[model samples]
Target: MKSSIVIADDHPLMLKGMMNYLSSLGYNIVGSATDGSTAYNLIVKLKPKIAILDIRMPHKTGLEIAQDCKLNALDTKIILITFDKREDVYKKAKEHNIYGYILKEFAVEEIETCIENVICDRPYFSKELVPNLEKTYTNTDYTSLNKLTKTEIKILKQIANNKTSIEIADDLNVSPRTVDKHRSNIVNKLKLHGIHNGLFIWASQNKDIF
Candidate 1:
């Protein structure tokens, strides 16, 4: 029997393309959703064998939906798709224990391999994702960067994006103090303490990938 799967992405063209590709490969295309909320709702009803989720959806990110699925005790294997290629996102996905991680640029054959591996209970991470993740640790000043955690790096990205601590806290569902603590740690780690203007400049230069 073929494995049942659901594909969730905001873009219609990509969504249809993925569905057609997977169908051609002989996997059952159980359903498709254009946003994370609908995906979560459909998974609860459809109970597919696997879910292919796009990372950058509008309502809630693929990461957020994954967490919700896990909390609800859903058994569907998750295959994460992303174009961001950001180390922070990759680290978070690994921490979430996802079944497969696929970069958008990888060949369709690679995606098929990922699905097969994950269905067999093995985790699969595309080769590009691994190196991009390693690039995070190699470039930053390890001695000081060590003081900050992966979560902190995520928060740092939010700050660089011009999000206020309150905004970040609300979005991540954390307390304001937690956000502030992350900011403080990041500033100290980069040795940009008391240098508000330079913080953005430094982050812009580094682009958060070594």
Candidate 2:
């Protein structure tokens, strides 16, 4: 069966262009949305094999939707299309288990291959971003991350995105105190004592780690 896909983008022209292009490429275009909230709802309802989402959109960013899908254990694979090359954004994509990260400029050239790869359970980072992504990975302090538990890592990613403890708790379906404990443990493990907003600072600076 052809892989089913739902696409979302806030730009009318970009959204139309991508839909037409992907339809021409022989995939089943199951649905499309013009905003992030609608996209998230569509994907969850349709449970398409894949979802192509623009990184920035109304109501919620693609990364935010992807994170929600993951937390809810939804089966739909996520492909985030972005114009940004910032390491922090890339790191968030990775942390949220986004299956594909295609740069907007290369979407026409690379989206087909990205879909093919992700449908087979492989990751697809745009060629233009891979070199820099690799360099960031090489410079990451894996030792520090190794000291953190999986839950701590998840909380840290949320923190890096500037989420408050209450927000993290709500997302993780835990109490505020539980999130606070995890935050404190993360700070201690990373040795971020005696500094104002140390955990926040650490998370901001070490995007590649989480």
lDDT of 2 at 114: 87
Model 2 Cα lDDT, one tens digit per residue, 19-113: 89888878899999999899999988999999999999999899999999989999999999999999889878877878889999999999999
How much lDDT does each candidate structure score? Answer: 0.77, 0.85
* TM-scores of the models, in the order given: 0.62, 0.66
Q: Per-residue lDDT for 45 in model 2?
A: 90
Q: Which stretches of candidate 1 lie over 4 Å from their true place?
A: 134-210
lDDT, residue 139, candidate 2: 54
Give model 2's TM-score versus the native structure.
0.66
How many clashes in candidate 1? 0
